[model samples]
Target: MIRGLYTAASGLVAEMARTDVISNNLANVNTSGFKKDRAIFRAFPEMNIHRIGDPAVLSPKDKIDPKPFIGVLGTGSMLDEINTNFSQGSIKNTSNPLDLALTGEGFFEVQTPGGVRYTRDGSFTRNQQGYLVTGDGHYVLGLNGPIQLPDGKDISINRRGEVFSDGSFVDRLLVAAFADQRQLLKEGDNLYVSNQQPLPSNSEVIQGALEGSNVNPISEMVDLITAFRAYEASQRVVKANDDTLGKAVNDIARL
Candidate 1:
């Protein structure tokens, strides 16, 4: 009964974790450049079951025999990992010059207080210092360095990420792509950090637009329902085991 309780509790934990991921995805459905996370589960190792002859039924002179293999007993399961889905989201025109979007796999490098980080969000605005910055005020890095743009008027950014003012050249945007984005870890605020070296990006930038979040509300809602049902099932199993254990401790012990 104790083992059953533990096993059933593991299911509850796994389902709770899955629910957390689903809720997070749903919450970020309208967030720009947001990526959804996927929860993966793994089953515990199975134990082989075999039949053993009753010792009391065997004679002292006769050796006990082992019966044929019965089956396998499952212990439990757990949440293995939560992998972030980096699929591209739809780009929408915002009509703001600082707004940008990536058409392919790439990230915009920015200089933050916590060092440097990468993000797919291009909803940028100029800071008080006339430097192009993200919504969070992180400096938008350029090939030269932090891009300090001229006055807001007559500014244009090309698909090649080249900045121009009155047809005059300005610093190019620092668009970076990682060799393996799986190594990147989310650091919150729609930014990712990685130790891997960046590669030249083939992605094109679209100015006056922003990327939408990749989360699907309907799919996430379905998953949330499934997780809740799994959690309820586990709860029932736990209650059943508890009742059995109580019966064993009270009635069976008195027998």
Candidate 2:
């Protein structure tokens, strides 16, 4: 009964973790370039149950009875990891000259206060110094370095991510990618950090647009309900175990 209680409690804890992931996804439903997280779970190793009792029940000097395997008993479950879905999000046309959207796999490289970081958010603008930067003022990087746009009323970006101001070529946008995308880690502010160096991406850029978040609200709501129900079931199991333990002490012990 005690082991069963612990198993049920483990399930309850796993469900709580799942709920937290779902809640975060729902909150970021409207966030630009946001990706939803998935909660992975794993079960503890199972123990083999025998019909004749444990083989260690007898001393080494004494003869032991044969122990036939009956079944396997699960210990508990736990939340393993939270994996981010890197699939592309839907695009929205902002019609702003500085706005950009990626049609395939890629991220924009920006020089932040904490060194370099990558992001899918393309809501960029020109700073007072005429340097292309993110909404947070991080300098957008080019092939050479931080791009410094020339002063011009006409600013344009092509499908190849090349920038042109006043009909004069300036520089190309630094769309970066990694060999192993799974190595990328979220660094908040819609930014990501990777241990590997950035590589050339095949993504095509679309000016005057931005990518929306990839969160699916309806699916997340359904998962939330399922997690709540599972938690309730685990809670009931824990309560039942506690009640049985109480009866064993208060009633069964007296008998």
Candidate 3:
């Protein structure tokens, strides 16, 4: 009975973790260049019912007589990992010269307060210094360093991610990729830092657009409902176990 209670409790915890991931995904559904995360679970090691807490059960009854094997019973499960989904999101055209997006696999490099960071958010603007920067003022790194746009000039970027003004090449945007994308750690506000994988230089960039979040609202809503149901079921099991324990101690013991 105690083991059963623990099993149910584990399930509840796992469901809670699942719910958290789903909620985060739903909240970021409209965030540009946002990638959804997923929760992974692994079952606990099984317990042998016949040999549980009994050393005497290990002895063979007879050499010829077969002792039927009892199947292993599950203890429970838990959240093993939370993995980021790197799949590309849909693109939205902003018609702004500063706004950019990646058509293929890549990330735009930025000089954040914490140092160099990576992001998919391409909503950029020219700062007072004529430097191309994110909406939050992070400098956008380019092949020649921070890109500086000429005042009142029509800017255009090609599929190759090169910025041109008055048909003259100004600078090329930096699009980076990771060999092991999973090693990247989230640093909040959609920025990522990666030390496990070196940045790859082959990714292409697209200008005049921004990548939408990869979150799927319908799927997340369904998962949220499932997590809630699982949590409720676990709550019921815990309550039932408590009631049973109470009855054994109070009512039955008194009788």
lDDT of 1 at 16: 91
lDDT against the true structure, per candidate, is 0.91, 0.92, 0.86
Per-residue lDDT tens digits for candidate 1, residues 69-165, read 7899888999998899999999999998889999888999999999889999999999888999999999999999999988856779998899988
Best by TM-score: 1
Clashing pairs in 3: none
Which model is ahead, 2 or 3, in terms of TM-score?
Answer: 2
lDDT of 1 at 24: 88
Would you estimate the TM-scores of all the predictions? 0.94, 0.91, 0.89
Ranked by TM-score, the better of candidates 1 and 2 is 1
Per-residue alpha-carbon lDDT of candidate 3 for residues 209-252, written as tens digits (9 for 90 to 100): 88999999999999999999989998999899988988889999
- Which candidate has the top score in lDDT? 2
Candidate 2 lDDT, 12-96, residue by residue in tens: 9999999999999999998888889999999999999877655654766875557867799999999999899999999999999
- Over the full model, what C-alpha lDDT does candidate 2 score relative to the true structure? 0.92
In candidate 1, position 231 carries an lDDT of 96
